[model samples]
Target: MTHAATANLPFKVHDIRVEGLQRLPVEKVYAALPIQAGDSIDHDQVADAVKRLFATGNFEDVQLGRDGDDLVVIVSERPTIAKIDISGNKSIDEDNLRKGLKQAGLVEGEVYQRSTLQAIAGELQRQYVSQGRYGADIQTKSVALPRNRVELKIEIYEGKAARIRDINIVGNTLFDDDTLLKDFELKPSHFWSFIKGDDKYSREKLSGDLERLRSYYLDRGYINFSIESTQVSVTPDRKNVFITINVAEGEQYTVNDVKLAGDLVVDENQLRPLLVIKKGQVFSQQLVTYTSDLIKRRLGNEGYTFAEVHGVEQDTGSDNNTVDVTFYVDPGNKVYVRRINFTGNAKTDDEVLRRELRQFEQAPANTSLIDLSRQRLQRLGYFSTVDADTPRVPNSDDLVDVDYKVEEQPSGSIGANVGYSDSSGFIFGANVTQNNWRGTGNRVSFALSRSDVRDSYSFSHYNPYYTLDGVSRGFSLFYSKIDFDQTSVASYAADRLGGSVTFGYPISEYSRLSFGATYEKTDITTGDYVAYDIYQFLDEYGDKFNEYKGNISLQTSTLNRGVLPDRGWSSTLGLEVAVPGSDYGFYKLNWSGQKYFPLTRRWTVRTRGEVGYGDGYGQDKSLPFFENYYSGGIGSVRGYESRSLGPRSPGMIYVDNGTVDPSPDPVGGNLLTEASLELIFPTPFAPDSRSVRTFLFADAGNVFQTEFNDAADNVSWNEMRTSVGVGLTWLTAIGPLSFDLAKPLNDQPGDDTEVFQFSLGQVF
Candidate 1:
């Protein structure tokens, strides 16, 4: 039976006496009371106050009653946290588990809630499951302690990591098992017999492995391959598991004919290069998707609103698994941008956003303009996040409005750091910058640092739009003093002051070309330094060993906005040459290439390679000290110290008495050529975050004297040192942080190869 509150009826209220609160202030509870002493109480108000108190999730129960025209309230308060105990966590240390739980708002000596304890248990299970422990279990219990408090005990049963005992694949007749198995990291056995067997496995890894197999076939023209079923069986001992993957491998197909259908504003020939599938080529679904995206981008650049491309695949029924591919173009209703809306900006002005937008109101919404606008916003650094969406207008199919949503973030930051290492020893540095720079397209930065090896001060500014025509210009000035502590063959101390000014022009929607010139005066102090033979020869030609130098470089980059890409490649080429009118004269050329291929949704393979060469001009035969590439450092060779490789020279060898040795010896000169290769592995942890990624990399490279021009001839396999290690990289809130633990695969006698390297920025 339900009773309704009557306004005319009055209920006797008792003196309001609240109980069972420790941390909560008593005054707060009293102030929330709806009934007072010596007055008639309304049942509805009393009930509402009790409901509010219970809804706080702070009390186990609440009771209210009227006593002699006064109100009384009682609450069984939930206990406050006193202590937390964690047990049975061996793989992840107890401290780490506690910290992870604490991040989720579970901490000792704090208020306790049943829901919070349940949440902690769930998070713990997820952490263990992600590490391949599928059979793990966590249970939480609360025990009352003295003084109205409670202690929590988190019990964990982390079973052994699942192991793969056997793996079988069916319907893979086109390729053998050996070729397909190589793509997976989970294997039945490790390469080395003495090492532990490859037994770590999980259902998640099995799914990823199956996806890899499917994508491999799809990328190679088997567009219809699919995994029908995947099954796993566990052994009675609970130590091993067997997996079976049943796949459906359809016929291999090739493109016999290619055609374009639907409305086209541009000629078909203009769009041909963007197609991935051509006549007489293999028919790959990945290629079709990439072709579609490419056409969309091209049309968007041309101011086509709502442009879309669809791939129409037809079976040719030919003997060689051939098919005809037709790309149906739908340059849907060309709509103009009626308005550009900005949101989530409270401090910044509307003009600030408008200045960065490439697509203006009333103009045709094109892909190029939107992309440029996004880049400009990112460069401003005023917003931590920015996104754009085009919501269609109701009852107007041909019209849409663009919305640029931004999450404003602090535009100014300062950082200070201190650390020590064997290579650089003790170091301290600080940087201050204002990314917004008064809402203009400019940035100002100042940095200062002092280390065992170098001291420097720098100031720089960047203008994203330097000219009314949308050119980018930037300038920077810096002064530095570097001291090489003779850990390597060629070492010297130098003081330098330099600055560079650059101007960039957009060659196309995807390309930019820049030309810049730099001037620097390097005062080299060769007190006890032994000059290389090349330096001596240059000295004979009346070239000062220490002097001023300048150089001009032409740089170009073709970048595709690969926010989402099927397959993409980026390449950079630079050319710089210095003549003898300055202190140094050298001709240098550098080339770098990178390719990213999404083998599947869960895995990607990225490869990068670089090569640089220099030739002496006039009296100079090699690069100057500042321009030369120093190997064997954190940024270069990971396992050794900076400038510690190559040939050795001797001059003024200081004995214990600090006197120079009269006899001198010869050493190697700058390396004429160098190359390196890195294989990157993206981790599942923090996958969506782009600023940082974890990878397992193998690096091999060396620097040598010009006389050893042919690496194969003069370099031994032992000299070709290789370092394999794991690294943690952060696309940091400020910039980047990179740390690596590298070990030389082949260590030579008397080589001082350190096992770790730490750097603050990108390697490239």
Candidate 2:
């Protein structure tokens, strides 16, 4: 600035001019100038403008001057940032560090300020220090570049986190140090600390640990417990931290009585039963809090969304240490839902989602119904995430809007493949399955496959909500030609065509009764050599026949989740009978059940059982060989091939060669029984426990026949095949894939034992 600009005398400015501008607009400088054309100004005003310009941080220096009624503003502009490269950052991700620097105005392509860099470095140091990285260091450099730009580089050294060396608890007589510190997340250094990192010190972690310690006492009836002080110190080497906590243990208090004393919108009798803290019980902060929450939720279910409930303790004057408790209830406004809206459901229809909701618009908000509705939507398995929020309506305290935002996931699979295999040459197949067909919540599936051993075509459609009363309707048609000669079975060929219609009635929320009718036509051809049992059966019942059958089943499930349930039980009991008017008259009864018991957050114990029996009631006098029950393999007894464990075929006899094969072929039996005990554990390295699971299972079962020629074929628990195995089920994009490695614990001489079994493209 010139001496005339700094004169104490006041003067009227005629014009203003800005100098030393690069990359910055002229308007930026004019905006910061207080003295403009035709405005009165003084020395203080000029200094004020100079100070304001510097405050903008765009100018390195600012001065004002006058030249014959022309105010001249001279300023030194800061350099724009050309590049910012941060290195030596290990504990923190580089992207997060860049974001932190950006928030402090130290980003690339913007004007650079040395003070901002210093501020960022200081803040970074403090963050690391708070995390117990006392030796953490930070250094910054600004390299001047051409074209009025600067390059910034930040170097960080995040030292190792300090380890907890000693944790001492003083002034506690009721509880020992180990008992109080057992649940604390922070602990003293010990072996394997490198892996668990529980010994690592952190200010935030310590705060949480202190709160846990306080809760531990408060929950154990120490009503007057108080923490005197807590001290933390670091060693000179800065590699270890010592923590000391002193607490005062007071007399235990017992509850004299629990009484409801606040505004009881609901009946007092109804709320009183909800209290977990009863008369003459030891006082517990945890129980009191739980009872308060329970009461609040009970009120919330009655449309009080903002209800508040708390238990207040009043110490009775006596040495008995008994206290009277009163629960204060504040039932807030009854909020009504003005509208229920949905979003992010691009493929699923509105009605599909609406049908699952128990909450409705234009009704008072019910907390239980709203939560249950959300759970139902999630259990549908069509959405990746289902979230519902009820926000109060603008300008209205009694009205709220319920909004559900869902992210849809592909609930179906479509696959096509063409390949050649030795067992099935020149294989060509196509299959499509959709659970939410056309956004209508219907299930549709179609399959077409061709190979040397088998050629199959099938299609099915099912509507879960076929009726307004939750009745399900489904029908399917299938045609298949199979050659048993190429498989591990007695030489035979069959061509079958069938169609069935099924109807399901919802008996209750967890129970359903279903009825189905089927008609099938079968044509069979036997090879020159076949199992003796099959040969005798084909001779009696003609190779070609038509059959009609009816089926009824009752199923109930109380599973907590639709996928990978960890709790609850499910059972299905069904019977299928061939109509008397048909070519065959037979009946089959089957029951299967499974129950899951959760052992921990990531472990579950499961028990499963299945039993089946079939026999003819009319002229046939025996179950058809094809309709017989065949056990063994993944779904039954592992370590045995599919349909490989059962009554033997006696022996395969070759009529052409006049030679008999000693090895027996598995010819299924009339009765089947299976039981399994499993320990289901979380899938190792799986991103989600719901999509994958692993289990160790012990299986015991075998098929038996009443018309057995030997004791081995007879129904006997001693003859039941047993196996132990580990299995993995992964719900993948293609479908559920399951594989198991099993070892048969008991195997008869004629029993078939295959260790490994697997199935792809199946729902679990």
* Highest TM-score scorer: 2
lDDT of 1 by residue, 1-764 (tens): 11223334366554677766767787767666555666665666766777777667667777875444445576777788888888888988988887887887678766688888898888878877666677899989999888889889999999978677778888888888889988886687455522543557755666788878877897788878889998777676656677788888887788899888888877888998888778888877788889988998888777676788999788877677788888899887777787789899876667767876778887877777876787666545566567888887788876778888987655555678899866566889999776567666476888999888678999998786687666888888989876666223233445768887878777764456777777766665443344443234434443233333333334333323222111356666776666456656676677666666666664555565656666567755445434554456565666765555554433344322344444443233345333444444555666665444566666666654453222212434456556777776654555556788887777666455888777653433
Itemize residue pairs with steric clashes in candidate 2: none
User: lDDT tens string, model 2, 606-667?
Assistant: 99999999888867777888888998888789898889887877677774664677667778
- What TM-score would every model get versus the actual structure? 0.55, 0.92
Candidate models: Cα lDDT each: 0.67, 0.84
List clash counts for every candidate, in order: 10, 0
Off by over 4 Å in 2: 1-5, 407-410, 414-425, 482-490, 655-660, 687-689, 707-712
Q: Best candidate, lDDT-wise?
A: 2
Question: Deviation in angstroms for 186 in model 1?
Answer: 18
Q: Which stretches of candidate 1 lie over 4 Å from their true place?
A: 1-333, 342-358, 367-387, 405-429, 432-445, 449-455, 481-491, 526-550, 558-567, 621-627, 650-669, 672-676, 707-718
